[model samples]
Target chain A: MTRNETVDVLIIGSGASGAAVAWSLAETRMNILCLEQGDWTRPTDFPANGRDWEARRYGDFAISPNERARVTDYPVNDADSPMKVANFNGVGGGTIFYTAHFPRLHPSDFRVRSLDGVASDWPIDYWALEPFFAENDRMMGVSGLAGDPGVPARDPPMPPIPLGRTGAAYARAMNRLGWHWWPSDTTVATTEYDGRAACINLGHCTPGCAQGAKASTDITYWPRALRAGVKLRPRCRVREITLNEHGMAAGAIYYDADGAECFQPAEMVILAANGIGTPRLLLNSASARCPDGLANSSGLVGRNLMLHPWPQVSGYVAETVDGGRGPMTSLWSKQFYETDPARDFVRGYTLQFARGAGPVAEAVDSLAAGRLPWGEGHHRAFRALLDHRLRIGIACEDLPEAHNRVTLDPELTDSDGIPAPKIDYRIGENTRRMMAHGIARATEIMEAAGATQIGVSPTLNSPGHLLGTARMGTDPEHSVVNPWGRCHDVRNLFIVDGSIWVTSGGVNPTSTIQALALYIADRIKQRLATLFDPG
Target chain B: METSQDSGLSALEIDALRRLAGVLIPPDAALAMPGADDPDILADLLATLGRDQARVQAALGALLAAGFAAAAPAEAETLARSRMATAGPEAGTLGRVILQCYYRDPRVLRALGQDPRPPFPGGHVLEQGDWSLLDPVRARTPFWRDDRAGAA
Candidate 1:
């Protein structure tokens, strides 16, 4: 296992996209080598208790303590940097810690520019990606309700999870207001669809799932790829993409398990290292042939970063709703998902009614709202409120802007001497207006649902669903990747992650990311001789 | 007991944190004993408890200040109760206080009769039936040194 092995295909970063690509290519008999930066650990390793889980899951040491020191670290601030780093490393990547809400983007989302003058339209339309989306949903075993008038109908592979009290209350409120809402489409299996157990509604999907219900890529696709003879090397951090004299990607240089430098040569390379890491890697791989960075022909290797903005509005009800009993978000409303002329903002928002909170999260919420920390006053308040709170989250679509971008800081570097991702972002006027509308609507819904008193936090920026750092387009001068996720500079170098998204849809991007990976793998398979053959 | 001077904490900051923690947990006055004089010792206790003591203190102080502002003629405790009641049970002021107490107070632990060696309840516990109850160990055994290297 020296640096001499030659593989047919080398994939960097074994997250949702990488895992899907590996699984799809495993059947092609290609010698595929997938590299993951974090160590491979199972769901059984997660802590059951709240306090320990909080420390292990939310702490900076979420990854292996050694590898954790090397990754990009950003501190949180209330004013400027409100983005909390909710990302995870390892085989499954962020999927292991996500809330598992898997909603596909509507057809209109692809034509945002045509519908409104806010954002640019994606080069590939919904019709081109519809089949791949279906395939991805089927492969992931999505549990959801079909025939909701508010959204496009796609027959789910499994039935939706049973609606709990929180869901019921939200549904009633929606019905009262005549708003469009439905059971959220999630990756959790409902009836043991694909050798995985169904969700038991543990309400702790933020950390790793203990019940194996959350369909993390490691559990769903990576295992299948391994069984099909794909070689997966966990704890392998890719440093740079080495190019040949002909200006094509030759192989990747990475740090092995023992922190030793190793290089693996391949005919073709795929970078699925997410929106943030993909751009960082590309920018860091500066060389003589590519002066600005690898695939920096357009000077757009790391630009136009987009994240779905989320602000929460919560309330208290009279009934005992055990808020911490089920999956984090089981129901969502798309009544305002599509853009309207009445609103000032070009993009719309989705209202998600989900389970309340864990004990720790609830405490944090109370503290944020200005409450006394302890004593008889604290005891009386806790007893009065423990079982009656109903929480709702509003997720607003943030349209991609040229100014909000990710660039490498010349000064700051990680422990491994890699440049830190310098994010120059501010909440645009359109997004702020959309958030205000969403918060007001959410507050009205809560009040109508017999809520005694409701509390709404001011607008906050969301760190989840990072997208569009290297946007896809038909032209090479304006975009980093083509419509098929192939780099314009290097034909064999493909990127399939949120980085390729042209617009941030008003929904979770995981399903779309997997669909894009599937589409790209299919393209590679069809053009195997032209792309991968060693003449 | 280390006083504020001994602990190197400003009297205002320590007093604020102590009052906030007391409000969060509202200890039974009968059971409430005089806290250690050393603010440093109290600060160490809070740090050992592993909770966000500063944020709790700041939030509690803001709430009290707001309540006092709203009802000038009303008692401080009554105003605090009214403000707490507005949050309701799941997210009410009292529940948050109890959570803070559970995190920052050794007195709460002593009342529960738990060992303070590991500090937390589920750390390194082997007999726990639930596999999820155990703390995450990075590498249980090295692959080269393990018995099931070939089997794995």
Candidate 2:
């Protein structure tokens, strides 16, 4: 085993949170190094560069790590979970394939327990992270209108991307229904900013943005972090976090790209591996001092897993909506975002109106649903469904449940022979009710939009927003991390990823996750003198 | 028809695919759109068959078991619908390969009114929807719960 030189700080996983924290801590001029298991994603190598772009979604650019299964990728044992794990292992992480639909959590989202009498309230509130959110928006170059009544009034950096035909139809429907709708805040640049070119409406943003319009962390933060002297070593798969005699995280033992074992010591360690990855690492690092896990004193290192359940309603309208012509998501509705006493479910869902699928996806999906038959009048069916379809995806808020957790799969191991994460998750009753309500409401909107045919997917297997595995709270007994992302059990160890999210809000979480990383980095800088004070 | 030796597909498998592709997507004279069984599309399908040979063969087996070749055109259509148009794994794999290859064809793409090229460098322009549509929504008072002023 090779023992490398020590550093002032070490960060694991160079995805959304890792890149943000690295950039934030760069100005401190500390010897900071981030170890990423995946390499940088070359924009030219993205699927959209070829005519087989849409087909690549099911292949190389698939959201599921198990499906993509590159050498750098690790398999996730998600067969037991209804909602499958969707993540990319590259430097930009999930953002590499994210549709870039950006939405910040509402003020009420922080106080879930206080407001709805369910789940635990976050130690920090939305107001505390508001400044960081704004900062992240600016850095990520969010594009949207200012006057959204669904959340706080904050103008984005660029004008909203054009609401193409599909968005227009949904907007008109929402207006007719007297529901609140706004042009969505997306990370895709509408006008050129920060050296990246504006979107040319190539339409396939999920499979990595070859156009460089989508704001993946690699394009937004990693470059700045690298320029600021943060040494980010890619393809170094961390095996475990080692502890000194006192149980403080000394550093990590990782496997280099050549499959050689190496140990790199550091003064402090931060885990930015997302919800599942963080817990898997902790569980795999079980030692005699901390038998359960490194930060498992609370017995909650891998508990309280929250995956936002997504249900969608798709339909076909008479007019051509230009299915694959613009950003995946251009407009959204927050009508059912908050709690209503009359409703069965407590927290509600965000209605994201997105364009329909590309030709290949639509055909495959429709055929699977038995909507498009393979004979006789197939042409008529194809024409009616192809470019005329639109979708309303309901991002349902899933509260934390102890039973839904991430454990190291005893049988499944990665290429490096490290145990993979086994997810045992199921949608809760509240989320199920919320999905039903969302489907009914979305059906109404589809009808209002003059949709001739409509279809409902009660639950989509795509669990892109993984949250709350290593929840942060004031109570150490019930949480893994403290309010500022410091580990409750280990003072020198910190987590600044979705794993620290107390609750999964009913929206895409990249924006909030990045803001929390920035907030944690700021807190770390503020308490530089007393950062490791065992208090 | 020239055999696709590189694809490793048998003459029987090629014939089976040729038979199935026609019923899967019949050509439209009115729209001037070629079906999945068009000479150009079938050739492309043969070349691409190597990638998904197992799944395609499985689907073909299912079709043959259902007596798709012996049935009348209408009966064959019914058999295909019942056997291939399903949520089953074999159906999914078959549908994906057939549709992916068919849609990527320049003739099929043009018939569908899509530009027959990759979706980059020559991206399409879209009309920005009317901003005035949000006037009614903007008129409503902010509905967010202000935590600073205390819980609602």
lDDT for each residue of candidate 1 in B24-89, tens digit (9 for 90 to 100)? 344454544223322433555344332334444444455646654344433544555555556443
Judged by DockQ cut-offs, the docking class of candidate 1 is: incorrect
Candidates' C-alpha lDDT: 0.68, 0.88
Model 1 lDDT, full chain set: 0.68
Model 2 clash number:
0
What tens digits encode model 2's per-residue C-alpha lDDT throughout A74-180? 99998888888888887988888788999999989999888889998899999899999999998999999998888898879999988778888988898889999
Q: Which stretches of candidate 1 lie over 4 Å from their true place?
A: A49-51, A54-57, A60-80, A371-376, A458-463, A532-535, B1-20, B28-152
Interface RMSD of each: 17.9, 1.3
Q: Give the residue spans of candidate 2 off by over 4 A.
A: B1-4, B49-51, B62-76, B150-152
Candidate RMSDs in order: 11.5, 1.8
